[model samples]
Target: MSTPELHWFKSSFSSSSEPGDCVEVARTPAMIHVRDSKTPGTSHVTVASATWESFLAYVTE
Candidate 1:
């Protein structure tokens, strides 16, 4: 099946001074997509929504 188009956005925590050094994220109903902002055309990593949420909670704590 074809992958659906994703709407990506740079993380707010990313350093604005270094535009090329930012991380981008896209969300779906059950998945979260991540990629380097500088290399948007390259491959991205996908994880379950729950896993992404757990990761965020861990890192933020």
Candidate 2:
């Protein structure tokens, strides 16, 4: 099977004023993908949607 293409985007909080210092994110139905804008080729992390949501809630709280 082949993986579907993902559309990655920088965080809204990420300003053009800072170069290569932001997080990029992409998503699928079941997983959230996260990577560093500075090193897109190095490595990345994938987490469950629920885990990602919980993380966001905790951080925002």
Candidate 3:
């Protein structure tokens, strides 16, 4: 199967003062994709939608 199109974007909360310290994210119905902003095309991590939500909840807490 072909890969789905991803709309990658960096977080507004990122600390831009530090180079390469930001992360980018992309979302699909089934998964949430994350990668380092500095090297986005080189590597990424994908997580289940539910797991991504849980991680956000924990991080925001």
lDDT by residue for model 2 over 1-61, one digit each (tens)? 9999888999765668878789999999999999989998878899999999998889778
lDDT (0-100) at residue 6 of candidate 1?
Answer: 99
How well does candidate 2 match the true structure in TM-score terms? 0.86
Clashing pairs in 3: none
Name the top TM-score candidate: 1
Better of 2 and 3 by TM-score: 2
Alpha-carbon local distance difference test for all models: 0.91, 0.88, 0.87
At residue 22, give the lDDT of candidate 1.
94
**Number of the candidate with higher TM-score, 1 or 2:** 1
Q: In candidate 2, which residue pairs clash?
A: none
* Displacement of the residue 35 alpha carbon in candidate 1, Å: 0.2
**Candidate 2: where is the Cα deviation over 4 Å?**
13-17
Give the TM-score of each candidate: 0.88, 0.86, 0.83
Q: Considering TM-score, where higher is better, how would the candidates rank from best to worst?
A: 1, 2, 3
In model 2, how large is the Cα lDDT of residue 50?
Answer: 100
Off by over 4 Å in 1: none
True lDDT of residue 14, candidate 2: 69
